[model samples]
Target chain A: MSIKFKHVSYVYAPATPFEQKGLDDVSFELKENQFIALIGHTGSGKSTLMQHFNALLQPSSGEIALAGHRITPTTKQRDLKTLRQQVSLVFQFPEAQLFESTVLADIAFGPKNFGYTDAEAKKLALKWLEKVGLPKSIANKSPFELSGGQMRRVAIAGVMAYEPAILCLDEPAAGLDPKGRHMMLELFKAYQARGHTVILVTHNMDDVADYADDVLVMEHGRLLRHTTPSEVFKDRAWLLKHGLGQPAASEFAAQLAENGLPLLPQPLTLTALTHRLVAHFKGGE
Target chain B: MTKIIIGRYIPGSALIYKFDARGKLLVTFLFVFAIFLANNWPTYLVATLYTGLAIMGTGLRAHVFWDGVKPMVLLILFTSALQLFFSTGGTVYFHWWGLWLTSTGIVNAIFIFLRFTLIILISTVMTVTTQPLAISDAMEWLLTPLKWVGVPVAQLALVMSIALRFVPTLFDETLKIMNAQKARGADFNSGGLIKRSKAIAPLIIPLFISSLEIAVDLATAMEARGYQGTSGRTRYRVLSWQKYDLLNAGAFVVLLILLKVLG
Candidate 1:
């Protein structure tokens, strides 16, 4: 089922001195198969919202309709195993979650948990292992033996092996090098293209500009804005006020406008910026 | 956060908090010893009153102490139940199916329960009022005499401080690992003993690896900072007697005397 959140609110340590409002009246609906970027400053409830995808963190108030399952504050964890299997979450620094003796076994863990047969789980694990660009020979090696990047790939692959309908990630490429980050984002983009919904929580505006079809902006645990990435950066003043950065291209376009070449439509991506510059110069000729 | 309240330090500036950590630790130790002197009803009542006064002096809500004691409640009940079932002496009040509840056992159980609870509450009071770092520092200062016996007191204090520091870090990691595994459908609850242990495998392995990595990183960081066995190191926080410490120690002595006389 398509996902929808209705007035969802979560409070940590409710009714106590240490109580904190994790999410405040967050309401939104997401279309299927779209790459959604969940953007916010730290402590803006992005991770809290991400946890609600699979009912990992139940809302204190509202109902979440996620992949045909109705999850409320009263939802039993036992009933959400299928929901979790259908909608997976890869937490930040997922490599820290790796535990199995071998890379392939770790990758196969999710599928096996989701009720796939042993053979089927092995097949899925192998497919994802290759898909994540790890060498086939390392399948038997302990995950701890792999390099940090490889370990990250294995941890990510383990979650993706089950082929969840919706995949939510919290800074999945946070500490990776540039090339590794690009490759990891490409994997998620490809997954989204293949009819799976992807929700990515990231601080990188460039990645949002490059990949996201929808952007969900959060502030003080509220969904302040839910729009396209272009729209998110369109209001530079708003972005600046909220301490958000524009994509490199958008920032460059803004600079170009200040330098007297005012393009009618601001470009949000590098290719669009190049095309805009080329057209602006050619039009002048 | 996992909300493991034992030895949790809540930020407060009550009378107990104003007292020196060393004084608090010593008083807590003396209190534990005094609680054992609580044999009969009068002594237990005096012990309870002393503990209640200490709890009130902390200026923390009663529930905070309750939260600390809540987890051990089952164990406490079980221990008390064992005392009820065994120890055949005095009047046999009840007998059923190889179980005996004698008057002596009943009194013994009540005393044991009071001792356990009073000790726990007093320890919790000291812990909640005093910082972990302060506790470690006070421990080092209190064990100063052991330096003459060739004990590595400073190094021991450093290790204790580091271990105490990692409690919250490791607790958070445990939670993170558990949630990560749960997302992949690793059922921690609702299983047989074997099923549960199997589920815990995913959690424990990750936690152990991460903690090892953390310890290594900490060691490297400490070495890089030239932490040479605390030699030529002056205290950033020197433990000293506070104005309220004398009063606290005096009150504790009064408590012991009261318990002794009442018993």
Candidate 2:
């Protein structure tokens, strides 16, 4: 099922001096089982929009349809556990949410809460632990005893253990090393391959280009565009206007095209760029 | 989380809002002592009238004052109920295991409830009308006499203001942490005492860690901004006494005179 929004808007501290329009009458339909990238600069309502996916923050006006549930401003917090079980949200710096004594226990937390038996929770936790690239040996250790990156993985695994049909992440790989970032992106890509929707919020244009089949571009509390990633990166002027960056490969291809070595159907990833470059040179030969 | 409007100030343009922060702070501090001066019905009535006038002067709706009283209502009722049940004297209404309701007990209970409610309402009036920054500034100005005793008044004032600011920040942090845990299917509100506490552990740990991180970051940022403590600093917000501020103090003096004469 697709997630749908109709005239959703969110206001922070309404009717007060500190009142601000967090999301301004946004509307979008997101299809299931696709990797969707939510891209925007700071204070563009990306976080606000992410919170709406699982009814963490209700719309100030209008309504949302997530799975079979209808969420309005009156959707109480108690009624949202079912929705949250279907869609897990990994907040920015998810590591800070860790409180379980052991990494294993922490990873099993979501599954346990979602009604999995201890054995079943443990099995899922161990499975996702290795899937997220953590060592099995670290499972017994206190989550606090692990490094920052390892703790982040444990926290991510914690939410992923229940195998929610939809996973929502806000900058999940932010602040990681480049190698770690690539591995995390690959994991998310693999998770999406299992026919579950993965909605990600990231500033990295390259990741969006690499993994995102759909791109939702937000600006100043408004959804500027909801289209394919290539279409989004195609407009260099719009990206520049919004202070957004380009995927390195597309940018390089654009420069190559400008220098009279055109690679048609612009490359979005390194692999695509390599193939395009090889074909262009081979065709030249 | 509790709706704590006790220390919250709503900014508005009113006569009470115009009173100098220093005078308001002083009056509020003395009012605590002044409440005790009301021993009899006449004195209590005078105190109540003064409190009523103060509330009216704020130009705020009654609900704001009601909110100030809501949090302490249970405690006041419980204490008043205890006094109503226990304590001895004239005409006995009830007798139990070493606890008896008497005429004097009823009077004391009523007085206790009145004193607590009036104190909360009047303080609420002061807090609601004055900005937190103004309160801190007034506190610093009032404590200036302690400067000769080697007190770090400016630093203390800075600490007090920062603490006041963190109250809201900590509350927001608590909310964020609670939501994060709730996303994981941790049911905080629908459980027995033990289960509820277990659910809340996630929130407290994260909140505690984040607060420490925030404090450290704040200290580093302050150092980066070259915040040297209490050295050659000039006041950006100066406190000056106005005619209305004098009227505020004068009004209190008149109330105290009335309280003494009538009680």
Candidate 3:
């Protein structure tokens, strides 16, 4: 599902002594099937913006729309529930959200919430568990007994069972080792291949460069930039000014470019950089 | 999500920080007692002026104090209404639906409202000036004499302090869990009472499970750090009675005597 924000602003503890403005006039749009990466520092409204995608939070003053549904304060409550089903969010430290005793029941919660029969929900849960590379035998085991990575997979599978049109992940790779990160990326790639839109909110630049088609940078509860990954990385000076930097491969390429080498073509990954170097050497003949 | 404002103490390093927690608690209790013992308009005026001065000296924001006292406004109004309709002394003013209104009823209503308002204001002042940790520490110290009864006051206070410290952390965790459940089409705010409660069940289960995990981790960390409870433990920062505390205690005794004479 495509998501759009129109001049949204949210203030916490409004009309109270401890009131704080969490988001300030944030306006951006993500088109259908766009793998958008959202990056921000702590309390920068990135999580707040993610909530708006599914109408989990209504903008205090402005507007949000998912696909064709306008999410406003006056939006019908029933409509909001339907919108949530269409747009699923997997939160940071997802393992902490697992509650059902068995991995199977935890993954089936979403489908059950959406009115799936018990059998249908369990079937959907098993399908997603397999999709996340978990064997069906582990389905009957308690979620709390699983390793951290397995628990995270079960939590993600829980959301995936809903077959949402759009999926938003908040720091999905946090606390994961390199191998776990690779597996998560592969899972997202597979999800994307199935034509579902993906929105990843993260602090890691490497993931953004490797997976995101477009990027949105946030600082201090305000949107700083929204553009294609290549374009965002090209403005290296601006990124640095905001305490953000290019992906490591792009930084290496930039150093080469600084020394009068025209070899790096806005490289986003090490493999791409290596291929460019090989092509340059071959072209030297 | 925000509860009673009066119960929340805005952390600061003002002059009130110097007073021992036990001294402050005793003084505040006496002050509240004095306010309640006030008799006629003259006594009420004296108590009101004293409380106003104490509030000003505490350096609390007047607006915040008023906000904390706002919830009591309804109770005050209801009490005023009861007194206005039920009192039977002084010159008769009006009558309606078998209810008689007299000048005394109006005066009594005003008096009761003012009296309760003063009590509430003084209590708010005390709480707003003292942090929860200090309050608990004071409680533990005062209840120290109760150790003869074999009470685990220190343990109780530690549990309370830890719980208070984790309030914000748990609040954040709950918000995260709510968002996660909401994302999965768990309609929390939009259903029948039973359905809404059912939706919340999932949220609570996850929150409780996570809290259990956190508790385990915290216990492990505490044991690893050699925590053996308050017994035989020396505090890095200890509360010692200062000149101000002594002076404050003396003032409290004087206030109690004065209140008794006026009553």
* Candidates, DockQ: 0.54, 0.37, 0.48
Which candidate order results from sorting by lDDT in descending order? 1, 2, 3
The CA lDDT at A50 in model 3 is 81
Query: Per-residue lDDT of A132-202 in model 1, one digit per residue for the tens?
Result: 99999999999999999999999999999999999999999998999999999999999999999999999
List lDDT for all candidates, in order.
0.90, 0.89, 0.82
Residue-wise C-alpha lDDT for candidate 3, range B1-263, written one tens digit per residue: 22223357865666766677778787777676667777777777777777787677677678867976799999999999999999988998898886879998988898888878877787777687787877888887888988879898878878877787777778888988887877786767776888877778878998898788788998899889999777877755467889888766766666666667776
DockQ winner between candidates 1 and 3: 1
Docking class of 1: medium
Candidate 1 chain A, poorest ten consecutive residues by summed lDDT:
A13-22
What residue pairs clash in candidate 2, if any at all?
none
Measured by C-alpha RMSD in angstroms, how accurate is candidate 2? 4.7
Q: lDDT by residue for model 3 over A1-285, one digit each (tens)?
A: 467889988777787657777778899888878688998777777887787788777778888877568987677667676777878898898887788878999999999989899999999999999998888999999998899989999999999898998899999889888998889887886787788889999888889888999898888778988988888888789888887888898988888888877665678888889898788889976
lDDT tens digits, residue span B1-263, model 2: 12333267887898989999988888988999998989989999999999999998888889989999999999999999888888788899888888898998999899999999999998899889998888999999999999989999999999988888788888877876777787898888887898887778888888888889889999999889888887787777888888897889899999999988987
**Residue B14 C-alpha lDDT in model 3:** 68
Model 1's C-alpha root-mean-square deviation from the true structure amounts to: 3.6
